[model samples]
Target: MLTDTRNSRYAKLCGTGGKDVRWTNGFWRDAVASCAKSMVPQLEHMFEAKEISHVVENFRICAGEAEGDFDGTFFGDGDFYKWMESELYSAVLLKDPERFQRLRAYISLIGKAQQPDGYLSTKQIIAAMHGESARNKDINEFEVYNMGHLFTSACLYKRMTGEDSFLDIARKAAGYLANLYDQAEKTGNVQTAVCPSHYMGLIELYRTTGDESYLELAEKSIRLRDSVVDGMDDNQDRIPLKEHKKIIGHAVRATYLYAGVADLYAEKGDPDYLRVLHDVWHNMVSTKMYITGGIGALYNGTSPYGNFFKDQKIHQAFGYEYQLPNVTAYNETCASIGLVMWAYRMFLVEPRAEYMDILERAMLNTNLAAVSLDGKRYFYENMLRRAKKLEYELIWPLTRSEYILSYCCPPNLARVIMESAEYAYAVSEDSVYTGMYGENQAHFHLANGADFVMTQTTDYPYDGNIRLQISDIKKDGPVTLMLRIPGWAERAEVTCHGRTETYGKESAGSYLPVALSSLEDAEIVLSIPMKTRNTIANPMVEEDTAQIAIERGPLVFCMEQPDVETESLDQIWLDPSAEYQLRFEQIDGRRIGVLETTAFQRKIWNGNPETDPEGASNLYRTLPKAEFEPVDARMVPYFAWDNRGVGEMRIWMPYRTR
Candidate 1:
């Protein structure tokens, strides 16, 4: 019982707890541990004020502990569940007894709060107690949404600790959901607009228990989305799942629904699902996706042609084909995390290197950037550019505060970062593939059922050099090791047992396959040249046309106000022909590379013509021959922006292409 990557048809890789593979030393291992150590303790304080109180207070409502109103938001219950899941993931690796005790306490309270018939949603239960009309009929209340998180969290907990205390509560709750939705599916009366996210959880329940009814419930939940309601545009269930050629609607909901579709396709191998999955994925990456691997282009912008709701605007949906925005871009952190989830599932089904590329892009940039360096504060909306205004911040500026009203992104980030080791490596029948690079120890079996242990040493995503050593071999036959060739690498080379090989046309954005008959004295050195290069957006994207962004290896770089003259990010333009020097610097506890470039700033001024006629005449006159001044410009990783008290930051800078 281990939490590993499982498609409906295949298991790609076991997680860190599995006997097959373990992480020894790496940037990811340190990141996972550091984030957990900093975050898990603070969560009790963070949630007690809101999320944890909701669950505890709701339990007391039934038990008559005190006369009180229902506490917290409707989705608050899921936040607590996510926090527990993150703690359990960290505890299993660290074997922390104190954390395990805390988990047991939470489970005990949750178990006590459950109704005898297996219903466990705190808000719905309270609504019933208060004699509210149609307590369970309103799907908009997120009844199943909270249940979904509960089911998945319990499944992972059982896998990590072999503990069934919480699993018992989860199973009972899952049974209730199956019965209710199964009946709803039969009558064609289900609510599709409320959200179809519960499909993923039902699949998890089926996977954990091998229950056919649970799988059937998930299938019905997905298929029933074709019954469109009036205001479900945000849910993306407007079209039948099989006919979705392009991704649309709420970005988080869109990716979560697709992840469930991928799960179903893995199990049922439905051609319709597979076709739509590929179609939507291609549509996103080719057009809708930002260069930082972020999705969802617009927030509450109205085009006067956008269809419905009181807001009269499409909220957080992918707008026109190439209408990506910068300052007002609403790349929610949960949406970015959902993209990674969907991509990982696709990778397991098809085993494509391109999927891993997108996964890496999301994990290294927008996803990691959601949390501050101290792991204490969080960002709900990630903006590509932060603009300054004298009265107030133009756009919602990034903050290092721990709490937000819609506190969904922080816990999700914590869990993903803690469990990142599981996404690093994958083992197939006759091959082992490196999904993401980091220094770590991995163990896997060959085609002959013999165990092998390997150690990877590197400072990855910072430097491209990696060394892999086969430390022990139980038995060896024919084996192939696949190394991923990142899309940004100009060149890649591998030296295996003193024989060197260079990358060619066939290797770019693909895997490099190396074959060996035995593992004795096996040491492979892989070096991918990392250099600072300018990035250009699609010419169709009006916001970024003719502007350039910098990227080094897998990291996207931005010009922050602290690193440049104040309010000069927009003034400076980079000379693409000029060479930039890389300098190592310490940011917080991490060592990051900074790029120094010689850039030029053209001076310009415009005044209110009505107020000063002389100023208006001067503006029409020649402006000192439009002199351009040389300025010193520096860039840090885009993820590192907003750490210096944040006045302004821009990723897309004006550039001199010639």
Candidate 2:
């Protein structure tokens, strides 16, 4: 999101900076508050706690400040960079001077670790110290991904703190890349991109510094992919990206690829890039994406297409379309974060409601679910469903872990969570766009040199009512404010300047452009009905054939074992007509909306026919008609699950009608 394209010809909207928006109350405010209090400090401890993560120690050893071997994952350097970036946001949000100073110190240490040539990968640096060969020049060992994080974080550091030390390291690193890629081309060392975060990084470098060479280098990097002699879908290199029709490969790599491409489209407006993005984005949303806006369906599987003889196995990848299996799903948290990034960029380039909807869905659900409510534990893979017993051991823990050996997700989610306020509002030459609804205040400085400050109050997603007050107009005339009418909301109404207009389903998924004039005591308001809706999946999705997923506004609701009366979930039926009681509950000391309703648990006949004279032990029986016994059922937001304790959890369930 720090990839600035506000003035680009193709970018329809520009982001609001820290001075422009602030989350004061409601769900997002609570999430950010939790991140500052629990998530960041805890992560700082864990990263410094060498037993859990040697991320800091690796840097220290590389810089000759400490003595040790490289002791963490190949990508831990990038993970640490992301954490540092998250702290920058936290420091600003809290206005804590000590926090800001700590971040400045960390960045200075990072500067010390950077090599003279601007090359800074801890794994490669530490390996070189022991006379080991540098690993595959940024492709195989993910040096490029680390560089990508470093560049963006450096750019953020420059923006937030006005520091040049980190930025200087990033610039040198960029210079190093420029030389390396040229050398790679001469030596044929460029194979293909793996975890291609560098693409976004290079373009952001161009945006921040206004340098032409970095932008050209980014284009060259994408071009290099077309000439790779041997490629595989495991890294989305099976074919040229422009020719890849469906998104199938490592989820993080694939989404990161698209996100970088989206950033490219925003700057250069390439038709091929836009086409490829649309194709991949459509395929992902309609077929591969989860109901909770999660991506990546397989824990481990081979890419279904390409030269079968040549393509390697795909790990943590998107499986065949509609091959959505709940219990065994592998929706990596970082992949969804990439989705949010890509969707935001796409909306900036094309400005569609669907894109923002996807962005909002992923951010609210899977991104929030990746970390626990307390923000201490984390999930490497976000499985849609969990069971009490299974034939196979969980690929990861059922509940979040305090420390994952592959610790990319926790910090990746952290930075995104800390900066989520940037995603809430956008601006153009004459109008301000409200992208996501939350309780916040906005100071809009339009490209046309007009300025206005707007304040909004809402209990959105829980309740649809929103009120806005505008003040301190600087322009001579009225400016348009484009309010997003989410694709999900129907039967909504808006009131502006004492004129009210109502809309139906036809108006869903489009922006309502409202022109505002200076007023003394007028308020703009919207009331969207946030009824608990029963969401049914397509019949092609076998796991959710007859089941329904519950949603209200933007929140997806799920049932955990502790919230239900029944011991087993196999026979539970949630009646669609059952009136849901909207109740407020304290979760992790935060008041969140919860739904309580009546559900039925089908009786299981487990008795042997001859021995017990009831039914076969198969837990099946033939009756005149299937009947279910009433059971107490309660549902909480999907993001809040697993926090109560690990047990059977479900998003989709059997359905019945009154």
Candidate 3:
């Protein structure tokens, strides 16, 4: 059995209590509010559309308001539960009394929806009543998936509120699942479930209740991925997980599975699991992921779907190895979140800087890009390139809009951003490692049982300067503070008590550890210079061959039609050796970082009859030097693109050879 203990070599949270952390930076605070503003209306619409009401009505059918059959998909209940989780976070952050009361009311309704046997699925209840054939006993129904979210939300709610009402409901639901699985196992007829998110939820339950059964169930779920009945490769159940080297199938499902695998490794200390995980992570980050930390390259490429079918209509799944297409990329918002989830879990296990680097990359570029600036609009599928007046819609099943039918990404992204405080700082025995940087206040305890409060101030992503102040330190020994030196940062510096330590290339991808004995008015300053530079992709990437993308600090920059005077995106080409000026401009009352540089317009090649002289087209003939005209151009953070109305956007641009 894996032990449930902290990593003695690294910093870990002393307990499951909420870190006394709050964002002091207006940039993040405003972004959080923007996401909340977007989420509240979505929640309201879901409420009005009978999304939440369906769950409430299902409970009433046995007794009160709703009757007959259930509405929406079998997996629809997970959406509502996720929304509730996001709303709960928003309520706490904004201190909105009215929103808090309304969510609590919905919690009560959900509680009333549970059955006597701890069964709490509205779809199943309604299906049984209507005599409709729902998903077979063959692990097809998304019941486990829904219950996983419920368990997670319940755990989060309990941690935040110290209230056990929701936790009690979650415990009951998990008990029912445990009993069902145990009975099936005893009969030698276990159903093979596809989604592994429940594995994560079960782990959370183990963390919450110290129950060995939940951990056992989580391990069983991972092993069950090899079970054959009705499972598909798209769900990542094609083979035993230990043998698979590449991350395949649905991007979100694969990430969720690996996340649970990571959690299990942390608790159980399973070396085989860790070995497989590192292999999968290297395969993903090195080849499958996008420059923007996006995944799920193609919805229906020539990848195996089920046991035997190839490209049998799979959505949001990774495509063949390097088949990345900019315009047709299916980088779903949920997949981006899943990427962060997987990376953060890996960081918890090893406390590596690259893990946090990926986490930050996903948060700033792909995930933040999913939501509009006002937070009212959303993008379900993030495209790397957009054409002008192309009448092109997202090739995925959904269209890009302020609202979506699936409605999963909006709330999910909102909640992830709102809870950014939790990821900023992590602590263990005698140290606190700063995984993410932002203006925030966090209270943490050292492994020696000493408590301290820290305030971090920074304009990160926009500016790389960070200052941390420690107060209220009660300690017997010196505590270590580890600051992550992002992989992209060069010439990073950390100053303490007028003593400065500089990190060169060797220390670029690791943490800078500093030990301090006295905590009376101690301050640490870190500076990572933010300079604009051209980044080139690996030559194996045919789409990006001989192309360059602009990057500054932690953000990947892109060219939007609004920022260029040229008519089309393809007409613009940047000089590889030109100097770039970095500055900020006001957009929607916010300062958006923009990079200005000298570029050229690709002069159209009209038939040069005079040069040809033969009045006939020739395959091999010397032509007049291609005419080029210099032009001034600007680029914005990739996340900030598409905000100034829809227009052409491109990240990889043609480089001028001259």
Candidate 4:
């Protein structure tokens, strides 16, 4: 029995109870504003100006056909329903009340276009009701995929607006899908046909509306997915989540499937689902995931097939691997967005700070980097590092001309940014969890009439000093406020009402709590220690096994070729600790730190007499520990790579040993 009261800790964190925290507030505001200003225009440009109209229009036409008559229809250019769902989520979650009117108009039009028998897909309506031969020819093109996205969009709209009209449409559409897959007596097939994207929508519908039928459908969908799991990985054609355990098939589909499974686990609290989720998560994190938390090993099919790392020839220039060939390494932005979406679902289930940690990293680094700073232009594919000017192409399957047209990333990002508030605050019965640090406030209700307020103040990501103040403690009982010690925090110090207490040890992903009871207007201050440290990646990566990356706090640092102003940045070395100095300076109105260190120049090999194997050459095995003269070097956040016109960037660097 959750009440819409403001005194509860959950309420405060959710912003339902008038509590303000810096991290949650800042992130919510920034995300909302960015999505509105950037994503909206892009989405519109795709529909209004770009070549994606055909695909989008075709999807609408097919949906119309499906709804009009019982017979399915396919208009053209494959199924675009998944893209529509992504757009819907982006619109509903991000725009919310502002976009409500437009959404209502669109939904109303859809309802009006519906059929009499509760079936509501444009494709079916066109083919079955109108008996249009042209539209009915390819009706089965992407039926499951389309149904999945439609379901997702409907659920998202209903949850955000609490409107039942959209829900009605959703119910009708779902009923159609359920009959097609679940109603064996009606469809004359015992087999269940499911699309990965639908699971997210169905699970969400169940969660919000508490529909047991939706849950049952979700379970059936999961079973269907399990049935096809083996087909996805048969040929070693996908990216291995572990050694010889590859996660294969279409990138978007694979992540969506995982997302559906995660949602099912959340709804049913099934231990098997949880175990499978863990298996998938572990596999992805260990191998399939990029440093920025993106997945999708192949660029061509946007598929997660093949061992690209082992076969260097399979690695593509754009981080896109079409059939494991190196010519195209286009890491699709949509795939990245999909990864973020899936990871966010994981966060909801586990409520771990790490999931959000990766989410933040992906958003700041890869997600934001996808589009230009101006927001008008966008890149569907993001390379590991930007090289030459890659033109935007309108190739089908791989490329679409719309900025937001059935092109999933734009709208997906929009929705995520809009609903960013939901991610900030998660509540347990006794305490509220703070995942990311930004400036924001929340309000929620408690069972009791007493009201509570929590406020946070800090400039984080740049600095680690956070101050949280609580006001209006209703009851004289012990209350707990949990502050996540980011995986990057080396040292954490907490001050309760000016009484400073230090937590001796710190780790990357853990939480620190401060207890308060009947204390009004009390403040808690957290000071995080930052220092430069050397780190080595997992030994599995071959070339850089001995190399070290510089890190400070939760950020991983990289050295770019431009920073050294050299054709090859292989000669730089860390000088002695005393000699190297870290300096903060303003670049293009942005404040960034630079680390200066000494390096030995590489000697030319002219068949020299001094070709000593043991002698100290230009290539140093270990970096000097002692102080030396400083050299100019720019340092960027590990997450912010590739945003500033990519050059050769290396997180791990070779250094001369002393």
Task: Please report, as a residue range, the 10-residue window in candidate 1 with the lowest summed lDDT.
Answer: 11-20
Candidate 4, lDDT over the whole model: 0.53
- Using TM-score as the measure, which candidate wins? 2
Kindly report which residue pairs in candidate 3 clash with one another: 2-268, 12-427, 12-428, 377-402, 429-447
What TM-score does model 4 achieve against the real structure?
Answer: 0.74
TM-score, candidate number 1 = 0.92
The alpha-carbon lDDT assigned to residue 83 of candidate 1 equals 80
Which segments of model 1 are wrong by more than 4 Å? 1-7, 10-26, 50-56, 59-67, 193-195, 301-313, 390-397, 446-448, 605-625
What digit string (tens of lDDT, one per residue) describes model 2 on residues 1-658?
Answer: 4657776777888788865688889989999999988999999998898888888888888888999888878888888889988898999888899998887778778888888888889999998999988856556687888998888888888877776888888889999889978987887766765778888888888888888898888888887887676677887876887997899989999888888888777878889888898888889999999989999889888888866676478888788889999999899999999898888888888777888889999998999989888889999999889986776787688888888878999999999989988888877778778888899988877777777678889987688898988778665336777778887887789998778999999988988887866534547898888888899998899999989999988999999887876656766899988889889998877787889999988765332235634443336765534568888889999999887776889999989876
Candidate 3 regions off by >4 Å? Answer: 1-19, 51-63, 133-140, 187-192, 304-313, 389-399, 474-477, 605-625
The candidate scoring highest on lDDT is 2
Q: Which stretches of candidate 2 lie over 4 Å from their true place?
A: 135-138, 519-522, 606-626
lDDT of 2 at 431: 77
> RMSD to native for every prediction?
3.3, 2.1, 4.0, 7.7
Candidate 3 lDDT over 183-206, as tens digits, reads 666665555555556777888878
185-296 per-residue lDDT for model 4 (tens digits): 4444333232256677676566556677987887775564323222333222233222333355445655666777666665566675567667756666665555544455
Cα lDDT of model 1 by residue, 1-658, tens digit: 2233443464454223433444566557656766778976676567665354455566566555545667776776677787887888777778789989988987887887777878877777776778864346766667777778888788888777778898788889878877776777777666763434567777777877787787887887788778745434567655566778877777888888898888787778888889999999999999899888999878764422235444445567787688789887788888898898888878777877898899999998998778877778788888888765333454554565677767777778888787677677776767788887887787776545757788888988888999998877887746788899988878899999889999864676888988877788888899998888888988999999889989988889988878766344656788888777888787777666788887877554333345643353342654344456777878888777777786778899888743
TM per candidate comes to 0.92, 0.96, 0.91, 0.74
Off by over 4 Å in 4: 1-31, 59-98, 112-142, 183-195, 226-230, 234-251, 300-331, 386-406, 446-450, 472-478, 506-508, 569-630, 638-646
